[model samples]
Target: MNKKQISILGCGWLGFPLAKHLISKGYKIKGSSTTVSKKLMLAEAGIQPYIFKLGEDNNQEIYDNFLSESEVIVINFPPRRIPDIINIYQEQIRSILPHIKNYQKVIFVSSTSVYQNTNDWVTETIDNKPEKDSGKAVLAVENLLKSHSKENLTVLRLAGLIGYDRVPGRFLANKKEVANGQAPINVIHQDDCIGLIDAILKHNSWGEIINGCADNHPLREEFYTLAAKKANLTPPEFKKSETIQFKKISNTKSKALLNYNYKYPDPLILVR
Candidate 1:
C-alpha cells in the first residue's frame, strides 16, 4: 500500500515526534511551525516543513499549498490561555478549515481539561463545562471543528501529559502548599499518547471524541510526592482538607474504541 501524506500543523513537542514516527513507517509527513528555526529542525527529521500562522490575515495560497498533497492533517497546538484568546484561536483554525476539505482525516489534539471537575468519572458522553481559560479555549475549538467538519473530526482529549522533559514530580518539587492534593490525577505517558494517535489512523477511526488517558487514577499527593522523590527534589506538602474535589477519568472508551493498552498503566511506577 502507498503511504498517505500527512500535514501536521503546529509541529512542536508532541507533533514533531509523531511526524518523525510516521515518517519511519513510510508515511510522507509535512509539518508546519511558527518559528523559522523549526524549518531546519523538521527538515532534518525528514519532514517537509512550512512556516505559517492562522488568523483572519492568513494567506490562503500558502495554506492551500501546504494542505494540498496531504491525506491527513493534525491540528496539534495548545489553546492560548490568555483571556479573549478563544476568538483568536477560532479565527486561526476556522481559517484553515476551508483548506482541509480534501483531507481524509483531521485529528485535533485536545485536552481533558475541557471536562469540568464533577467529582465523578468523566467520559466523552458528559457535557463539557470548562472551568479555566485554557479549557474554555480548547472546548471552543473542539466545537468549531465538530460543527464545521461535517463529522470528519477526531478529538483526542489527552490527560496531563507526563513524559520526557515534562515530568510531574518537578511540577511541585519545591512548592510549599499545594491545593487539591487528594484529587485524582488523570495523566498519560507521551509514548501512549503517540501510540493512540497511530492506532486511530490505522483503524481509520474518525468522527469521534475520545479521551486519551491512562487506566490508573492516582491521588495527586501520592503521585506527585513520588514523582518529586524520583527527580530528587523537595516534596510538596498537602493541606489537611476534609473536602476532596476529585474526578477519576476513565480510559475504558479509548481502550475499547482503539483496542489499545497503555504502556504506563501505573503512574506511581513513573516515580522511578
Candidate 2:
C-alpha cells in the first residue's frame, strides 16, 4: 500500500511543523504558502510546495493539483484581522468548496473563541456564542464548511496556542494592570496540537467537533507570572477584580474519542 497523501492549505507556524511530522510518519505532504520564498523551504523539508492564495488570482492548475492529489485536506489558515474579515474569510473558504469532493476528508482548524466566557466548563455540545470578531469569523466559516460538506468535515477547535516560540511570558511581560487576573486560562502546547491532529488522521475520525486543550486550567495571574519569570522577563502585575469571566475548555471528547494523552497537561508546569 502507498503512503497517504495529505494537503495542508497553510504552511505557516503550525502547518509547517505539522507537515514535517506527517512526513516523518511515512505520509506524503503537499503544503501551500502564499509566499514565494517559503516555497523552496517547504520543498527542502520534503513537502510538495504550492503557491495558493484563496481570494487572489492563483494558478488554477497548480491550485487544483494541490487539492486534487490529497486524500485529506487540512484547512489550517486563520482569519485575517481585517475590518471586512467576516465576509472575506467566508469567501476565501467558499472559493474552494467546489473542488472538495465528498470522499476527501477535511480538517478545518478552528479556535475555542467560538465559545463565550460563560465562566463554566465548555464542551463540544454547547452552542457557539463567540464574543469577539475573530471568533465570530471562525464560527461563520465553520458553519459554511459544515453546511457545504458535513460528512467529510471535522472541526478541531484549539484553545490559545502556547508553545515553542509562542511563550506566554512575552504576552504580558512587564504589563501593568492586566484584566482578568483570576480568570482561568485554556491553552494547548504545539506538541499536543500536532498529537491531536495525528490521532484524528490515524483513527480516521471524521464528521466530529473536538476541543483540543491542556487538561489543567490555570489562573491568568498565576500562569502568566510564572511564565514571565521562567523566561527571565518581568512578571506582569494583575489588577484585582471581584468578577472573573472565563471559559474552561474541556478536552473530554478528544481524550475519549481519540484515546489520546496530553503531553503538556498543565500550563503551570509548562512554564516551570
Candidate 3:
C-alpha cells in the first residue's frame, strides 16, 4: 500500500511537532507556514513547506497546489492578530474548502474555549455558547468547516496547550495577584496532543467533535504553587473571596472512541 500523504496547515508550535511525529512514523507530510524563515526548518524536518496566507482576493492556485493529492488535511492555524477573526477564518475556510478532495479525512484543531464560563463539566455534546471573541471566532470556523467541507471532518477541541518550553512556572514566576487562582486549570501536554492526533489518524476516526484534554483537573492554586516551588519562585496570592470560574472539559469521547490514553494525564506531573 502507498503511504498516505498528510498536509498540515500552520506548521508552528503544535503543528510542527505533529508533523515531526507523523514523519517519524513514516508518513509523508506537507506543511504550511506564513513566514519564509520557517521554511528551512520545515524542510529540515522532512516536511514539504508551503507558505500560504489566507485573505480575500488571495491566490487560490497556490493553496490548491499545496492541498493537492493529500489523504488527510489538518487545519491547525489561527488568525491570531486579525480583529475580525471570525470573518478571517470563514474566508480562509471557504478558500480551502474547494480544494479539499472528497473522502479525505480532515481534523480541525479547535479549542475548549467555545464552551461558556459556567462551572460545569463540558463534553463534546455541550452547547457552544462562547463568551470571548476568540472562542466565538473558533466556533464560527468550526461550523463553517462542518457545513462546507467535502471531506469527513472531525473537530478536536483542545484545552490550554502546555509543554515544549511553555512551562506554567514561567507564567507566574514573579506575578503578584493572579486572576482566577482558585479555578481548576484545564490543560493538556503537547505529548498527549500529538498522541491523540496519532490515534485519530491510525483509527481513521472522523465526523465527530472530540475533547482533547488531560484526565486531571487540578485546582489552579495547587498546581501553580507546585510549579512555582519547583522553579524556585514565590506562589502568587489568590483573592479569597473571588470565585474563579471555568469548565472542566471531558475527554471521555476521545478515550472511548479512539481508544487512546493520555501520556501526561496529570497537570502536576510535568512540574516534577
TM-score against truth, every candidate: 0.96, 0.98, 0.94
lDDT ranking of the models: 2, 1, 3
Q: Which stretches of candidate 2 lie over 4 Å from their true place?
A: none
- Please, what is the whole-model Cα lDDT of each candidate in the order they appear? 0.87, 0.92, 0.86
lDDT digits (tens) for residues 1-272 of candidate 2: 78789999999989999999999999999999999999999999999998868866565567678888689999999999999888999988888777888788999999999999888999999988899899999999999999988988999999999899998999999999998999899999999999999999999999999999999998999999999999999999988756778999999999999999999999898788
lDDT of 1: 0.87
Q: Clash totals for all models, in order?
A: 0, 0, 0
Least well predicted 10-residue stretch by lDDT in candidate 1: 96-105
Model 1 / residue 47 / CA error / Å: 0.3
Task: Please write out the lDDT profile of model 1 over residues 1-272, one tens digit for every residue.
Answer: 99899998989889999999999889999899989888899999999989987763757888888888788888998876666877777877888887877445899999998988899999899988888878888899998888877467899989999899898878998886788988989999988989999988998999998998888888999999999898889999988776788667888988999999999998888886
Candidate with the greatest lDDT versus the true structure: 2
Q: What ranges in model 1 sit over 4 Å off?
A: 56-58
Write down the worst ten-residue block by lDDT for model 2.
55-64
How does model 3 score by TM-score? 0.94
